[model samples]
Target: MRMALFSLVATVMALGASPAIAQEREQVKLVFEHALPNVEGKRMDAVLVSYPPGSKSLPHRHAASAFIYAYVLSGAIRSQVGNDPTQVYHAGEGFYETPGAHHRISENASDTEPASLLAVFVVDSKDGALTIPDKDATPK
Candidate 1:
């Protein structure tokens, strides 16, 4: 039937579009997670965030109870927390974010080179998600 054929075409087109959307965002992978034996009800989570040349993440926040430390692993990363001025961090440099801080900017500093960072989070064990993108945020 024509209806079934049209539905199949639409589905195929949608599937093809998904990868382009995914390619625009940075990649995040959990590298480690463990309960903090010395800190009651706290857990530590470490994630490696890879940014392809010129890629960036949307405006987002971490768990409300999370305190984060981010260290540049390779290349340079541009970052801004809360209302602070944007700063570019090179490999070996790092920064921290207080609990509930708004991460307004995060991107690769160079268009020709890739970048990466290790983000270590200290958060309550009860927190469900590590990163929460803002509802109204869109990729640039």
Candidate 2:
């Protein structure tokens, strides 16, 4: 009887310890408006990204050869690309991300203010989606 109870407890523990267990998922919501194929079979994807007060996006990268252009639409955002210095951008300002560059930091400039940006990506039509999160990143 005791052995059976131990086996049940072990089973429960194993089930609960699975890496795929449903926990809250971390995500970045990019509001893309349109995508169109252009010359040389490259496509353009236009997106609007919002960072709420105190919110941040994890370090990530784009497709193998995707170029990104980001324009601030409202509030202010702090970002760093690859090994460059971090900068804060306000409304109407813009930045660019080179293909294969590491997006090191992306967050609101202020904890009290929300920020948003329009991101446009130019990539090969068959390159699939634009962004890919860096799974090996360390927490900020």
* Tens-place lDDT digits, model 2, residues 26-88: 223444423453366676666556666666777899988789888776678899999999999
lDDT of 1 by residue, 1-140 (tens): 34633443344334331122224578887766889888999998877787878789999999999999887777899999999999999977889999999999999897777777778788999999999999999656
* Model 2 bad stretches (over 4 Å): 1-38, 138-140
User: Which regions in candidate 1 have their CA more than 4 angstroms from the true location?
Assistant: 1-22
Best by lDDT: 1
Flag clash pairs in model 1: none
Best by TM-score: 1
State the local distance difference test value for candidate 2: 0.68
* Counted clashes in each candidate structure: 0, 0
